[model samples]
Target: MSAARPRVLYVTDLAYPARGRRYGDEDVFLTSRLREHFDLALCHPLDATALMDAYDAVVIRNSGPVLGYQKEYDAFRARALGSGARVYNPLSGKADMAGKQYLLDLSAAGFPVIPTVDRAEHLHQLPAAERYVVKPKAGADSLGLRILPADGLAKLAGLADGTVLIQPCVDFAYEVSFYFVDDDFQYALYAPDPERRWELRPYAATAADLEFARHFIDWNGLDHGIQRVDACRAPDGELLLVELEDLNPYLSLDALPEEARDAFVTALTASLSRFVHAAQGTQEARETLIPA
Candidate 1:
C-alpha cells in the first residue's frame, strides 16, 4: 500500500487584478507543481477558514491584499491560531505578515531600512524632500499610498496613531528583490526602471548584497516558508531596505532560469514536507495529552 499524501489547502485570490503582475498565472503554475507532492486544492482566501479543517495544512500564497477581506482574514487567523491549525508560513512572521510597522521599527533601530516615521511630530526625523510617501500602517500592494509635499505634512498628524507611515520620497536608481526559501537564498530579480516596477530581470547579487538581504530574513526568524527582501539602490550607490515581505510574497518564478526555478521548487517542496512532519508531531503530542 502507498503512504497517504498530505492534503494542502492552497489559498489564493485567482481574480485579484494586481497592478503589474499576474497573480492568477503564478498561483496556477505553483499549485500545479505543488500537486506533485501533496493532494492540493485551491480556494479563495474567504473560503480558507471553512475548508482548512479538511486539509493537513493551509498554504497561503498570493491571497491578494488582506485589506480586501480584513474581517475574514482576521477570522481565519484567529481560528487557525485558536484551534492550533497548521498554517504554512506559521503565522509568526514579524515583518509584513503583521503590518508595515516593522519599517518604522527597523528604521529607528538604524538598520539599512528607509527612514520611516508614523507621526507628524516626528516629521523632522526624515530628510527634507520635495515629497513624502504617506501610506497606511496596514497597507499592501501600494494601496492607499500617497505622495504629499512638505506643506501637507501637518494635515497627516491626526491620522498617525499607529495607523499610517511616512517616508521621504526616495530618488533611488532601481529596486531589487532577493527571494528565499527557508533560510536558503535563491535567485534575485530587479526592476531596472523605476517606473516599471514589475518589469523584472535577473539580478546578480554580490556577497555584500546577500549579507544585506539575509539580515532581515534572520531577523524575521521564520524556520520555513518563502520571503522576499525588497531593497532600492540609492543614487549614492547604497541599498536601502524597502520592505521585508515575509507574508504572501509574489515569487517571480518567471524571471528565473530553468535550473534556478527548479532549485526553488525543490527547496520549497522540502520545506513543506518538514512543515507537515512538524505539524503532525504537534498533533500527536496534543492527542497524547488528552484524557482517555
Candidate 2:
C-alpha cells in the first residue's frame, strides 16, 4: 500500500448537486487517479478541519460554494493557517481564494478584465450598458448572481459597499477557461454556447490567449495549486478576464482527451508531492531550531 507515500486528505462532497456540472463525477475520477501516487482518503468539506491533522496535506477539490457553509469554511481556513497545516492551494491566493475583490482591483489596475465596481460612485468608470451583474463578493459558481437594469444601483443602498460587485453585462462571443497546475498550463476549454456554460469543448488556445491566462497566474504568485482563468471573447475579439478561480477550480476533466487528462493527473501528483515535501522540510527546520 506504499506506506512511504505522503497521505492526502481529499476534501470534496461526492454528492453535491451542482447545476450544469457533475462535481461528484469529476472528483470521483480525479481521486481514483490521485490515489495511485498518494495515500489518499476522502472526506466532506465540513469534516476537513477535524481530519486534516493526520494527513500530509489537505486538498480542497469540488466542495461546492463556500457561501453554503461560510462559518465552517472560515473556521477551517483559520485552523489551517494558524497551524501551518499544508493546504494544496496553500491559502495564499489573492483572487477567488480571498473573494471577488481581486476583480475590482484588477479592473482598476487596467488588466484586461470586464470593468467592475462596487460603489454607485464608480458607476462613471463602467461602460454604459443596458444591464449589470450584481454578485456577492463571496459568491461562487454563479451563486447569488443576478442581472439587473442599470438603475438597480439604487436598490443596493442598504448593503455595505464591498459586499457586492457590479459589472456591466457584456455581450461576448464565447467563454474560455484555461486550467493550470502550479503555474503550468494544462489545457483550455470553451463553452461554444454561452447558454450552456458547462457544455464545454476542447479549445486550442492561441499564444495570445496563453499569454493572457499566464498574466493572472503570474500576478497571483502562488508557488503551487490549481487555477482556472476564465475569460470571455469580447465583441472586439479580445479576451477579458471573467474570474480567476485559484481555489478549487473545476478542471472539466471529462471534456478533455484521455492523454490530456492523464497529463494533468501526473502534473497534479507531482505538485502535491512537492508541496508536501516542502512543508515537511519547513517543519523539520523549525524543529531543529528548538533548544532540546
Candidate 3:
C-alpha cells in the first residue's frame, strides 16, 4: 500500500462464527479488491480503536454482532465521535446503529415498521396476537431474542425497564432484503420459504419494493456507506421493516450474480474514496478555522 493512497483500517472478526454466513471469506474478497484503490490493513473489531489512528478511515465490515463486546463498541463510538475519526457508516445512524429505539419511533409515526413498543404502558397499542417477540434493544444476529405468549411478553421484558422491544409475531409470506450503497439500490434477495431464512435467492424487485426500501434509506440520510434494509411480506401483501442495519450489515454477496457483485464493489470503492476525501476536506476546514 502506497502512502500516496488513503489508508483504510478494515475491521472484521474472522473467527466470529456467524450462522449461515462466511464473514471471513466475504471480507477477504472485498478487501483484496479494495486494496487496489487504497492502502488497507485488516484488523479485528477489538483492535480498531488502537489501530485506527494510522488509517485515513475505518471501514466496519462483517464484524459480527457487538452484543458480546458492548463496552469496546461503546468506547469506539465515543472516541470516534469526539475525535472526529472518519468512520464509515458515520455513527449518526438512527436505526440499529443506535439501537431499537427508532423502531418505536417509526412505529409511532406509522412508517411501515413492525409495530414496536418498549414499555408495558404501550402494550395495549400492539396488535392482538397469541405470541409476541421480545428482544433486546441492543440485539443483533438474533441475540437475546425470545418469543412469549401474549400473557407472558409484558412480564418477560419488564415493561418498567424498557430495555427490550416487543412486537406481535407476524405471519409473513417471506423475508426479503434490499441492499443499498448510500441512496442507491445495489441488489435484493428473498427467502422463498419463511422457514428457511438464510436460503436466499435473487429477487426481482418491483418499483414498490424499491420505493419501500428507499424510504428508510432516505430517512437514515447517510451520504455514504452500505446498508441492508431487511423486511418481510405480510399476509396482507404489504412490506414492513424488520431492521435497518447500518452498522456492519453482512452483505450476502455470494448470492448475487458475478456481474452484480463486481458492480457493488465498484460502487463501494468509489463511495469509500468519496467518503475519505470528504472527511479530509472537513478536517482541513476545521483546522483552517482554528485560531493561531
Candidate 4:
C-alpha cells in the first residue's frame, strides 16, 4: 500500500547447524538475489512475529526445525493467520507444516507413500522386515528417530499411543528429491549412495519419475508455493514417498548449474510477486466490505 517497493520479511535461522547442508549459506545467497526484486529484510525465526507487520510478506526459507521453538512458531502461525499476513508458503500446507501424521493418513488412503502405521496394533499390517523405523509424530531433521530389530516390534506397542509412526525399514538403493514451485516441476536431485544423503547429483527424472512426484504435489493441492517431494528408490525399483516437505523446503541452489539456478530464482521471484499481488487484492476486497 506504500509508494515504496513491496517489503518481504525473510525468516530464517542462519545459525542452524544442519547435518550436511549449510542452511545459512543457501539463505544468504537466496536473500541476496531476492533483494533485486523486492525490499527484503532478513530476521531470525523468533523475531518474525515482532517484525512481520512492517513487511509485505514473510518468506520462510531455512528457518530450521519448528520443533526447536514450537511455542514461538505456534504463536507466529496464529498471528499470521489472524492478521491475514501474506506468508510466502501461505500456511495452508498439510504436510510437515502440520506434522508427520500425513504419512499415516496418506498410507491409509491408499497413497503410494511408504507404509506408515501409528497404532501399535497395526504393526501386523507392515511387511515383515528385519528392522523397523520408529520416529516421533512431531519430529523433524531425523530427531528422535530409532531403528529397532523386528523382535522389538512388540515393545513398541506400549510406546505407540499415536505419538509415533512405525514403518518397516526399507533397504533403499538411493534417495531422490523433486523440487517444485507452484505446482511446476523445477529439478530433481538424488543421493547416488544411500549412506551419504547430502551428496547430491543431478537426476534425470523419467516421465514416470515426474508422474510419481506429481502425485504427491497434486495431493497437496497448493496453488502457489515451493514443495519438495522426497522419495527413496526401493530395492524392487519402485519409488516410495519418504516425505512431502511444503514448509520452508531448502533448495540446494548451490548444487544446480548456473542456468538452472537462475531459472529457479526467476521462477521464485515471479511466484512471490504473484503472491503479493493476490494478497493485496484480497486485503482490498475485505476493506471494501467494511463500512468506511
Q: Compared with the true structure, what per-residue lDDT tens digits does model 3 show for residues 160-251?
A: 36888889899999999999998899999999999889899999999999999999999999888999999999999999999999999999
Best prediction by lDDT: 4
Candidate 4 clashes between residue pairs 3 or more apart in a chain or in different chains: none
CA lDDT of each candidate?
0.90, 0.90, 0.91, 0.92
Better of 3 and 4 by lDDT: 4
Candidate 4: tens digits of C-alpha lDDT, residues 166-260: 99899999999999999999999999988989999999999999999999999888888999999999999999999999998988888899999
Error of 3 at 83 (Å): 1.6
What's model 2's lDDT at 59? 96
Q: Which stretches of candidate 3 lie over 4 Å from their true place?
A: 1-3, 151-160, 284-292
- Residue 65 alpha-carbon offset, candidate 4, angstroms: 0.5
What C-alpha RMSD separates each model from the true structure? 1.9, 1.9, 2.0, 1.2
Q: Write candidate 2's Cα lDDT for 1-292 as tens digits.
A: 1249988999999898988789999999988998888899999999999998899899999988888999999999999989888898989999998999899999999999999988867777889888888899889988889888877757744342778998889999999999999999999999999998999999999999999999999999999999999999999999999999988887889999999999999999899989988877887899999999
**TM-scores of all candidate predictions against the true structure:** 0.95, 0.95, 0.95, 0.97
TM-score of 4: 0.97
